[model samples]
Target: MHENIDPAICPVCGGDNGCALLAGQPIEQCWCMRTRIPKEVLSAIPAERRGKACVCQACAAGSAPARPD
Candidate 1:
């Protein structure tokens, strides 16, 4: 799956200064290869935009794990 994203823009935060994990990359080569993103944060993304988008480190880091209610 290839995410036709702006090379350096974050969809959630709208920041355009760094690289997001492009869609069609090998899992091992993807930018998200190292850090672990929270499932809650991933799910919060709108359905139509999931997998087709990539979040920046700042944004990912900002999404602290959700607490149980």
Candidate 2:
């Protein structure tokens, strides 16, 4: 038999469960959820500019800037 696990919903915006692995930071009680950047997008961005790019759950859900990364 298989069991289902509830997703980690974001408390702030009610976003679906997500991991913060993308940012290389520990997951806290935050509104942000981490997402991996596409290779194409990463390649397009300069090394210095990479710091400016971020993929947060808030940003994904059109909320707020959760993390600077």
- Each model's total of backbone clashes: 0, 1
Error of 2 at 40 (Å): 0.9
lDDT of 1 by residue, 1-69 (tens): 864555455555545424433445566765667878777566665565565556666667874333222
* Top candidate, metric lDDT: 1
Query: Model 2: which residue pairs collide?
Result: 8-17
Q: What is the Cα-based lDDT of residue 42 in candidate 2?
A: 36
- Colliding residue pairs in candidate 1: none
Candidate 2 versus the native: TM-score?
0.25
Query: Against the unseen true structure, what C-alpha lDDT does each candidate score?
Result: 0.57, 0.40
Question: Where is the poorest 10-residue window by lDDT in model 2?
Answer: 3-12
